[model samples]
Target: MLETIYTENAPKPIGPYAQAIKVGEFVYPAGQIGADPATGQLVEGSIKEQAKQALLNLSAVLEEAGSSLDQVVKTTCYLSTMENFQEFNEAFGEQFAGHEPARTCFAVQELPLKALCEIEVVAVVKK
Candidate 1:
């Protein structure tokens, strides 16, 4: 069976999709931007700050799905500019330290809300 996941701590989905979906032991989160849930505003700052917020958003969705960042098995990162890759990695790496999940990072022409970075995660939820 599949279950939809949501949480007020994470920004509400802007389109027709749930924050995450759990099937069996795996939880897959949608790509998250740097939008602040309470303020409903994109986080403003350097790429590192934006990346941190995006990871935080992904973390909230994982928690809602009965998972945690430590359980994340894979991640896909999108960046608005390749030049910001180093700054983004500094923030993203700190979040997943010691838990090194498989990942792919790429530069994109744009992102929703004009976010500097976005991240999606796949994690395992204990059954």
Candidate 2:
């Protein structure tokens, strides 16, 4: 069965998309930027801080889908600029240190809310 996952703990979607979708034993969480849930605004700070917030947002979405970062099978990271890669890597690495999943990072032209970066995850859902 397929289910759409939504939680007020994560930032509301800015488009016509569910925060995440769970089908069978898998869940695909939409890309999440560093927007604060309470303010619904991009967090301020360096790329590391923004990246941390983005991952935190992603974690929240996964949890709502009955999954967690440790259950993630893959992830895609989008950076506004490659120059920020090193900093982003440091923070991202810290978050997924022992739970590293297949990952990819791309330097995108831009992201919603002028976010510094965005992150999306594909995870295995638990019963």
Candidate 3:
């Protein structure tokens, strides 16, 4: 059976989609942007700042799904510009320090709410 995941710690979906979906032992979290859950506003500042918030949001959704960043087996990151790659990488490295998962990042033309960064993940539910 599939389970939908939701958490107040993360920004609510702006469209027709759940925060995440879990089936069997894996959970797939939708892309998380830099918007703050409390304000539903995109955070201001550098790409690193936005990347951090996006990761935090992704983490919250995973936690709500009985998973965690450490349990993530894969990640897909989107950046508005390649110029921010280094700074974004710095923030991402800080978050996944010891347990880096397989990842793919793309420099997209844009993202929802004009966020500088967005991240999504697939993780194994902790037993």
Q: Which candidate is the best by lDDT?
A: 3
1: Cα error in model 1, Å: 0.6
* Tens digit per residue, CA lDDT, model 1, 1-127: 9999999999999999999999999999999998898887898899888888888998988988889999999999999999998998889889887789999999999999888988988999955
lDDT of each: 0.90, 0.91, 0.93
Model 2 Cα RMSD, 1 decimal: 1.0
Candidate number that wins on lDDT, 1 or 2: 2
- What's the TM-score of every candidate structure? 0.96, 0.96, 0.97
lDDT of 2 by residue, 33-116 (tens): 999989999999998988999889989999998888889999899999999999998998898877789999999988999999
TM-score computed on alpha carbons, candidate 2:
0.96
**Candidate 3 similarity to native, TM-score:** 0.97
Q: Which portions of model 1 show Cα errors greater than 4 Å?
A: none
Residue 93 alpha-carbon offset, candidate 2, angstroms:
1.1
Prediction 1 global C-alpha lDDT: 0.90
lDDT of 3 by residue, 22-99 (tens): 999999999999889999899999988898898899999999999899999999999999999999999999988788
| Prediction-by-prediction clash tally | 0, 0, 0
Instruction: List clashing residue pairs in candidate 2.
Output: none
Per-candidate RMSD, Å: 0.9, 1.0, 0.7
